[model samples]
Structures are given as structure tokens and as C-alpha cells.
Target: MIKTTVIALLTAASLAGVAAPAYASAFGDVSPEFRSFVADSIVADLNQKGVHATSVEEWGDLIRAYVTNDNGTQTMEFFTPGSLQPVTK
Candidate 1:
């Protein structure tokens, strides 16, 4: 009886886990083209700054570009990738 109870509890837990809501990413609003443009611009800016970049990634509504400076230190920035005119903070 104890074994059956434990199995039932485990099955219930598994089912509950499966029924949990799937996470939706916040980046659903931005288009792929815009993201690409933003990433490209960031890479260009980094290059201008004399930073050697190896990769860039788009996460949700932000673009993270990784750059390696001459000193061999890696850095990243989160920017909203878009063609819209830049806004002042």
C-alpha cells in the first residue's frame, strides 16, 4: 500500500509539472530583421571602438554583443535593436 501511495504521488507530481504553463519570451514584439540590424550596428560600433568581437546574440527584446578588447577582456552590452531614431536617456 505504501509503494502504491508513493507511485501515485510521483505520478501526480509529474502530471502537475507537465500541466504548468510554458514560459513565453518577452522578445515576441521585435522582428527578426530589426534584430539583425541592431546586432550589425553594435558590431560595427565595437569595431570602431577597437574592440574585437567574436559573437553577438539576441535575447528577447535586447541584443547582447560580446567584444574582446586589446587587453583580452570580454564585455557585453544590452541594447534595444531597432532602426528608430536614438532616444536620450
Candidate 2:
């Protein structure tokens, strides 16, 4: 009986994780595969430009990147979605 109870509790705990909601991106309505592809492209381009880019994501209709600077500081940079051009204020 004790073994059965322990197993039941463990199963429930594992199931709770599976039932949890996935983290949503800004463009959650769009397909995840497309978004991943775009983000990956942006990362690759930025790295090629020697930007030291860490990660990229879609944010509010723009592509946002986390970049590390030569001074060891991190900053957020915005870019156009398709062209991947830097967006300046």
C-alpha cells in the first residue's frame, strides 16, 4: 500500500510539469519553427559582423538581440524583422 501511494504521488508530480504552460514569446501567435529560424539567422549574421550577440528573439514586431560589448557589458539591440537591419532611434 505504501509503495502504491508513493508511486501515485510521484506520477502526479511528473504530470504537473507536463501540464504546465509553455513560455510564450512576443509573437506567440506565429509558428515557433519560423520564429526559431529567423532568430537563428539573426544570431548568425550578428556573429559574423563581430557583434558578440548572445541570443535573439521577436519582440513587439521587431527582432531583439542581447549583445555583449567589448567592455563586458550586455545591451539590448533592436532590428528589422526580415532585413535584420539595426533599428535606430
Candidate 3:
């Protein structure tokens, strides 16, 4: 009985995650391949490193990253797809 209860709770939690609402994403003009790439490679890594991962915009080799901050000032970061570090002009 105890084992069955644990499994039921776990199943409900899994379903809850799948039923979560969708929010706006930052990327644009991305291919299907790139979409999975961003979710698996980019978003997961960024959030793990304490960066409030928001959106990724791609243009050829140039990728734009937007990270929300607490202050009023807004900023956008740039980078190459393979390079996780932000690029500066």
C-alpha cells in the first residue's frame, strides 16, 4: 500500500509538469533543430549556472540572449551558438 501511494504521487507530479502553462520565449526565426538545441543545450545550462534564462534570438551565426534583471534597466546579450559566453562588440 505504501509503495503504491508513492508511485501515485510521483505520477501526479510528472503529469503536472507536462500540464504546465506555456509562456513567451525570446528566440526568433529558429529552425526545428535549433529549438531542441536551445532547450537541451542552452536553457538548461544557463539556468543551472544561476542565469535567469529568458530568450534566445538567432540570426545566422549570431545569437542574441535576453536575461531579465531585478533593476529597471533592461539589457540584451549576444553570443555565438556554440559559445556559451556572451560576445561584446
Report, for every candidate in turn, its global Cα lDDT versus the true structure: 0.50, 0.65, 0.54
Candidate 2 TM-score, C-alpha based: 0.58
Q: Is candidate 1 or candidate 3 better by lDDT?
A: 3
Best by lDDT: 2
Per-residue lDDT of model 2, residues 17-82, tens digit only? 521121133334546775564455567667877778899876787778999999999999987655
Q: In model 3, what is the error at residue 74, expressed in angstroms?
A: 3.6
Clashing pairs in 3: 27-56
lDDT of 1 at 56: 61
lDDT of 1 by residue, 4-77 (tens): 99977875564345322111221234568754543454555445555565666756555456767678888765
Q: Quote the lDDT for 25 in model 1.
A: 26
RMSD of each: 16.4, 12.9, 9.5
Error of 2 at 81 (Å): 1.5
Judge candidate 2 at residue 35 and give its lDDT.
55
1-89 in candidate 3: lDDT tens per residue?
99999977875564335311111232344667746544444554455666666766554566566777777444676655544566777
